[model samples]
Target chain A: MSGYWAGILSILAINIIFAYGIFIPVASGQLNLGGAGFQAVGAYSAGWLSASFGLPVSVTIAFGVIVTGVIGVLIAFPILRTKGVYLVLATFAFAEVIAGAILSSEPLGGAMGISVPGYIDWYVSVIFAGLVTVFVFYLMATRFGLTIRAIHDDEDVSDLMGVSVRNVKVAAFGIGAALTGLSGGLYAHSFSYIEIQGFNALVSIYVLLYVLLGGTQTAWGPLVGATFFTLLPEALRSVLPATKNFLVTLFGETGIVAPPDESWRFVILGALTVLMMVFRPEGLVTRTMVERLQFWRPANRGVTQ
Target chain B: MLLLQQFVNSIMLGSVYVTVAVAFTLTIGILNFLNFTIPTLFMIAGMMGWALSYYGLPLGLSGPLPWPIALMGAVVLTIIASLIVERFTFRYLKTKYGDSTEHAIPLVSSLGFLLVLENLVRIGYGTDSRRFEGPDADLTMNIGGIFVRVPQLVSLAVTVVIVLGLTMMIKHSRIGRGLRAIAENPDAANILGVDTRRIVPVVFILTGLLCGLAGALFAINYGEVSPAMGEDIGTKAIAGMVIGGLGSIWGAVLGGLIVGLIEMMTVHFFGADTVQVMVWGALLLTLLAYPSGLLGHNTIGKGKL
Candidate 1:
């Protein structure tokens, strides 16, 4: 159960990082779905280095972040040439490559993944999540943030306005990817083991969902979304009858009962995203909250619908 | 000689990509959002087929499907699941909060649905992959030493037929013209008396059926299915869709096949491990350089050179 609590906290921290990672690119109007890919690189880097090289967990994490960050820059250099949806496709492809690489790269444990030292705890996760959120909030307030927002609104105009559209997008990708890598490092440090299976494209989608569910505008959306989303299912699992009354009740009463037994989390999440996009693109929190917190507003408030 | 075998293999995989990408293109074009559930649909089809087979209910016993006798029993089952998502999740959100620029909530909620579906399948069936049975099972036939299997051949034929038929319908059929009109200009299409709302459900049903059919074929072709299948297949399809340039149905088909061939060629030339994915990353970079997608109209942001 304590492990569960730790899992919950780690989920929160990872979600925070995931949300911010997505937000930074999105703030500039790019919907890159490759955070999970960067996280995979970082996770594998930390796991492999710590396992084979006997590096300190902290040093391995740093190495992992730096390595993934560099990879992010390399990828960004080519892909950011496209805008909006094209960027999303590029990142999604990037994540898939990472997943396949992890699955095939045996020295890094391939599909089996690798084990690393455990140095992160609940307190550490909480502190990291908080600090990262605060840092991102501040970063979005500066000139750099304003430019990203401007790009998000209108890339051509922003480019004309002297915003280095390409540079800023690349910066967003690199920074967002760094956060994903950091989360991977923390994940390795907390669990002492890592696998491609764990840090998969699905996790990337989950991170995106948490950020979206929490409302991407508010800096705290990731934290709130991660904490609630991760714990909710586990809690539901515990409450369900052994005979699987839960599925019946969930579908009948709530009309969203996940299929019994196998984790219906993916189906549930995917479906929810469609529904949410159609109905409330803003999430539970209003966009005004994000606008009011201008520093956290990676782009201009007036331009956003 | 080996190259010829790989080409066939590539085409077979490319057909699958075509199916999934077509579904995604329709949704994205109409709804103004990328319903990531497209992947889940692929997964669900596999799970459904797996569950039926696991219960000793072979395709022979199931009768030729489309199982219209029971709406939820056949291909229509996918439509039911999709509608459930649209109604409960998307409808609820749309009712609660109107569409805004923020993508966090909808994306996350839909993601939650995806997770739920995945986990439910996992709970019902174990994480291990399962073999497909009956008419859908693998049957090898050596055609000039290429060794075409039942699943692959059947799927390819079905794909060609479906694509051709659908293309005809879209180009000349009454509903097809409207769908195209809507895709071309939604407001204009609506003003011209195209019932966009009615078309939405029809499109969902059509796309879901494709996924379900293709999914079933994939299981039978490989003789094995896994929960992770969706993520991998979806990633490649996404790359195909982008590289071909989204929107045009033909674009998705061509894109999927090209990507499939590229993946196979890479695998044939490079070690089997790196081939399929390495090209995806590189191709994504290539597509990004174009920004209009391989064939899209133009970059959305007007930052074009």
Candidate 2:
């Protein structure tokens, strides 16, 4: 493949992994807006391990994911204590704390950021993304996934049904953190650099948006959402310029007629978000939609067997 | 003396945070909606103010107006944008499914608006910061060995007045009572003749007004405006709002000031790079220790995810 397509595919793969990392907790009735914090932990850990200790790529990646998972479990107790807007604010703060710590830590290269020695080909990311996707799909098919969905539908009812709400939430959060970490490690290795700036609050917001906009009701949400958003700018990269040219032709002469692709993409994203919430707040790949796609009967939608 | 000066400066900075935090707390309090668009509204006011001042009104309506008119125009535009946000996000809160993540719909849509508005501003103007030629940016006064900018003092006074007025409005007025009822229970309030549709937009109006004023003050005092200006201040305001308690007005005031103090002190002691860590760490600690925040009622955001 050409370098351009390779770059886009790699990014697409990383984003998919990251989105799933967020999807797990969200699916379990918790909003993990701290995805970037966990990802930063994973990326920086990989970078630091490879740079300082001369660790291999596999070791660094594993260590990064493990560390983030542990941290996720540790923080989940406090973070999950709050619900709704409070939960969102807490996670958002967590990401900022992580970014701030990295920015000030000398060992992490501070503001200048760190460069990684371990480099991975684009295919590595794609393979990892596919494995992660399958793993999440498999997870959602299990009894554990049912418990999560149960909690997501109604936490009080899930608790009454003896679903171990706390444990399920923590588990989902930790696993999500690990997956996010894996993506971050891939990002670090693929880009051959890791910076604190890359893990800012916007990254967390965008990842959360991807999962929510895709649909939190089913496993298909993250996949479709991530793929669409990852490819959106590239699609716009072609269409926006043409539209701008058309505008120029119609208007004849205007000041500064360059294509406003950067801004247009976000405007489109925002507009879609608004429209989706209004028309399909359940998201694009909701449970009913997924079941319909699977050709399942309406009564069997929530049944295990 | 220098320390005292820092204190005064911190309070001035806190005033901006106070305004924005009040805006945040109000929406979360009354509407139970975490309106992320507040920051964008803040940015919009400042950037549009800059655009109007620098480039004149669009379509050759008039030459670049005076500073006062530009700022007023900015605030008016922000209110309009906020109403537009209300139309999309809050209007769709009541859904048939009644899922756990239903409440997140408005929150997510606001995030979309954040992206849209910020990027739109970036597209209209360049992403770089623009010099805002407001009323005497360098105008300062020395009070008891501490230096204070005239515009900063004016903003601080204005913020105090507006917040106090808002508090009274929410406490004593019939509309205030209706808002409180909605905060208690939207459906009950609607049934009780609170006019949910009409009163709800009032929250957005107040949010827009507060954010717009803060943005204008920021531009006038700092003599700079940028498309990205809102993210930093907005996040800090969120931290303040959470710290003060989500639904409490006075709590936001104290929280905003406290955040400002923390920010200034962190810059003084730990250097500028660690400010994010300190502020966010404080927020994390607060959420863990006192989830309701310093003055938040336990019932405000206790809804299920």
Off by over 4 Å in 1: A1-11, A117-122, A153-164, A241-279, A287-305, B29-32, B49-73, B83-110, B125-128, B136-142, B225-227, B266-271, B291-305
Candidate 2's residue-wise lDDT over B1-305, tens digit each? 88888899899999999999999999888878888898889999999999999888999989998999999999999899889989888876666767678878888888888888788877778799999999866787987778888988899999999998999999999989999999998889988888988899999999889988999999898999988899999999999988999889999999999999999998888789889989999998998789888998988776633
Chain A TM value for model 1: 0.83
Task: State which docking tier applies to candidate 1.
Answer: acceptable
Q: Please report, as a residue range, the 10-residue window in candidate 1 chain A with the lowest summed lDDT.
A: A256-265
Lowest lDDT sum, 10 consecutive residues, model 2 chain A, at: A293-302
Error at B80, model 2, angstroms: 1.0
Instruction: Tell me the whole-model lDDT of each prediction, alpha carbons only.
Output: 0.70, 0.90
RMSD vs true structure, all candidates: 5.8, 2.1
lDDT, residue B32, candidate 2: 80
Top lDDT hit: 2
Give the candidate number with the greatest DockQ.
2
- In model 2, what is the error at residue B153, expressed in angstroms? 1.5
In model 1, state the lDDT of residue B91: 44
Error of model 2, residue B69, in angstroms? 1.5
